[model samples]
Target: MDANGHVQPYIINKNMGKPMADFAPELPKKNADGVPIVEPTDEQKYMFDADGWLLIPNVLSEGEVEEMREWVKRLHFDPESLPDHERTILAGPTQRLIDHPVVMGMLNEFTANPALSSQECYGFSLGTCGYWYRTAPNRRTEGLKEARAFKPHNGNGLYRLPGDVHFYNSFPGKSFCPHMRVVWELNPVKYKQGGTLLVSGSHKAVYTAPDEIQDPDSDVWTTYECEPGSLLFFAEATTHSAHPWTNEENDRIAVPTLYNQVDGGFAEALKPDEKLLESMPPLRRTLFRDRYVANNVVGADFKRLWRV
Candidate 1:
């Protein structure tokens, strides 16, 4: 009831089992292109095509970076009410954060971006935490000290490790899906503080043993050192790994998001909401095909723009 004697609108009315749109206006179509539109510069394209990774500096603002760091600290030190999954020292945000609009928007932007073309597959990696006490000592070990000599390995399934080593290849026989990964640094990177080590052109070559391959002479293989706000985008095929974090004083925190290129017609399987699809124009609907031209079509027909 209104205070002035007039009847008040049913502000708290509940309409269970009713279409939400019947009561409210529609939401903006964030996936108009079904891919990200931000075009990668020439250098970015070259790096991505050849090496399968790109280092983007200052992708997030200082404030946003601080907020993530605070969240990491809170999760790390306090476990009274946190879930068992989030108790690890290298925990990412709760499932709530993963579903948050900010994270979802970022994922959509990266996946649907027009520049990437629809050829890429997108998926999320389970948030992980790396703790020193639970693993091996990184500094004193000979295998951990030499970063360049570190062999590549993939964390496709799950494995526990004792020390720092460069990961160059994923598990053999495990159809390692081709994808990109977003690494959000929750902690700052000082020299030798395990950040991430990457080999530039390694993604183009087949998986090789450490002893069999020589170190790249070019500036391809290098350690990534950045502030907390930095976001790293790399190819799944790229050779990379967690750099050893010798700083026993501070813990290394990061949220890694993985995406990959898929075969064409993958989106057809999603079964999206009809109302959502209705709002988009036909041009925007076709954007997905434009982005991800199938490799088979590229190799076989070569004349056709798309496969399916």
Candidate 2:
């Protein structure tokens, strides 16, 4: 098997050896408007394939970080100024975060459906977006806290239908994770301050996870510290959860944007409205288009499937 040069049979052989897809050889390098694409370094790619997540430190400049924070703050504190529905969505320059250079590059390789091309569309869509803020009920815990703001869920090894968008696959020139997540930290995320949680490498596992690993004490759960403006990209196939926000003085302010293949989206309510789509360039607006099957699909039983 020429792992380096050849595409191999991937992922559906009864789990005899569900190899972890090597993510480096086929990362899509796509850029944002006026911004050059930020390709993942070799080490970063290796870490992403191995751990199912990667943190690109300071991907946004200090000034950019400050500006984004201000926008988010307005959305948070000045909710009354904006309608309820608008409060949770990106506003002003923050809307550009959907196709930010760093994020687009990763989405191209990870979630973008290779079946499609950039010439036609991004191959992925912004399924939803939201920010989370929290203040600890009491003093921040010095060690891992048992109380999780959100329970860990969704990983590759777990049982899922083949049609499930949150999937992981690999071959010679590309890897596929039809659904994924990107988190932009507006505030500093310290080691124990709590942001997001993930079970390292769980995305590629073929076996069901045991109850023990879900506990915060498992030591298998991984999180890291980074300055403001850091971007965290991860596969939805990874077992991930929200760690309790323990920073009381400030707040744990983070924006998480979910993405899925262009053919389908996960969050219908967050789908972009007509006016918003009309305002965006044709290409960028593809991120919010409705779900539809492509004109061409080979050997697929369309009628027998998706009866619902």
Indicate which candidate wins on lDDT: 2
Give the C-alpha miss distance for residue 182 in model 2, angstroms: 0.5
Overlapping backbone residue pairs in candidate 1 total: 33
lDDT of 1 by residue, 69-124 (tens): 66655654565666664553323422222323333333333332222222322222
RMSD per prediction, one decimal? 17.5, 7.4
TM-score of each: 0.47, 0.77
Off by over 4 Å in 1: 1-39, 83-151, 154-177, 206-221, 260-308
Per-residue lDDT of candidate 2, residues 206-306 (tens digit): 87878876686577688888888899988888998887777666666678898877666455624665566566655566676666556322233222222
Q: Write down the lDDT that model 2 would get.
A: 0.67
**Model 2 poorest 10 in a row by lDDT:** 297-306
Instruction: Report every candidate's CA lDDT.
Output: 0.41, 0.67
